[model samples]
Target: MPRSIDSFNRQRLITSYFSVTLSITLVLFLLGFFCFLVLSTQKIANHFKEQVAVTILIKDNAKSADIAQLQKTLSVAAFVKSLQFISKEEAAEKFSKDIGEDFVTFIGTNPLQNAIDLSLKAEYAEPEKLGEIKRELEQNSFVSEVIYDQSLVALIHENVNRIGLITLVFSALFTFVSVLLINASIRLSIYSKRFIIKTMQLVGATRSFIRRPFIRLNVRLGILSAFIAMLLFSLSLWGIVKSYPEFSILVDAWILLWVFLGILVMGILISWGSTYFATQRFLNLKTNALYY
Candidate 1:
């Protein structure tokens, strides 16, 4: 009968340990996922910003040599991410294809102007920089006009700022919630052994001696939980990369490494701190208080 009771208690203890470890692992995974999103926000924004193209239309009488010189100059500019020259013939063909008719042939002339599609670097995508670039390009003798959607540029800027602010707010809120959750799990696990702690104290165990094992055990649990969380996060990231290969370019390996390390350190610190404080609380309680 005594052995049966011991077996049941041991089983319960193991169950409790597993429960606490699983809880911590889930919380850490969510926190780490949010951290990764926060870190990659800027990169994602830049990727989209660089896709907005500014078109420079060429004058009909522009010499080929002058147009080539202009292309060479713009290609090396600090603000330019990439540029593609579209000849008038290519523009006419594309328009004809889109309309399902050869408008150039019908009119007996190709009216489309030669143009250069310019994609600016992320930093120069702002309204002020774009305005300066447009003015600069329009000053060129061979350039007829510089054209881009001003409203679209403004909209992108507004949306990026809004998204960044919202992400930061959610990151902070989730971090607080994660801390609370981990702390609660640790306290509950310690509570289960409150009687053992008191018994040890009654037997003349020093406070540090009592805390050492609990703290060490919880720290190990914390590290294990962190590893589990990181594994789950890596699998999720892998799935994302598989679905959208381009997304992999936005996430830096060093940033991911740091996030993983942060999770490990956070797990260990929170577990040790929570366990120490929970055990300390029980240690300071009166023997009679144990019943309540």
Candidate 2:
């Protein structure tokens, strides 16, 4: 009968350990997912912004040699991410297809000007930098006009700022919740061993000696939970990329590094710190307080 009772208690302890480990793992996973979204938002936004182009209309009588020279100069410019020269013939063909009519046929000549389409780097996509780029390009003798959506650029900046603020606020809020949940879970797990901590105190064991083993055990659990969270995050990222192959470009090594690092830090910090504090509570508590 005594052996049967011992077996029952051992099974219960094992179940409790599993439950606490699972709880911490899930909390870590949630924190990791939040960081992934916060980090990748900028990259996704930049991808959309890079599609906005600034068109440079060339002068009607500009020599081909001068156009080639201008292209070379623009290619090396700091603000230009990419540039493509569209000849009048190519522009006319595209315009014709868009309108479903050949304007050159009715006009007896192509009316469209040769143009260079410039896509600025993400940093230079702002209205102020775009204005500077426009002014600089317009100074060229062979360039007739530089055109882009100024209002659209302003809107993009405004929207980006709003998104950043929202993400920051949510991150702070979620982080606090994650820490609380993890700390509570750790405390509950330690609460189960309140009697054991008291026993060690009665045996003349040093506080550090008692804490040393619990801290080591909890830190190991934290590391394991971190690994599990990272595995789940990786699978989630892979599934997203597989479903929408177009967004694969946004899956950068640096982002992954930061996310994994964050998960590990969160897991270790919360688990180790929570275990330390929780253990201290029981260590300092009177024997009668253990009943609660």
The most accurate candidate by lDDT is: 1
Please give each candidate's TM-score.
0.92, 0.96
Residue 16, model 2: lDDT of: 76
Estimate, for each residue in 34-59, the C-alpha lDDT of model 2 and write its tens digit: 89879988997797678779999998
Model 2 residue 272 lDDT? 90
Candidate 2 regions with alpha-carbon error over 4 angstroms:
none
Candidate 1 segments whose C-alpha is farther than 4 A from its true place? 202-204, 240-252
Error of 1 at 127 (Å): 1.6
Which pairs clash inside model 1?
A: none
- Candidate 1 residues 1-292, lDDT tens each? 9999999999998998999899999999999998888888888889888988999999999999999999999989999989999999999989999999999879999888999999999999999999999999999988999999999999999999999999999999999999899999999998888999999999999999999999999999999999999999999999999999988875698879988998999899989988999999999999899878
Number of backbone clashes in candidate 2: 0
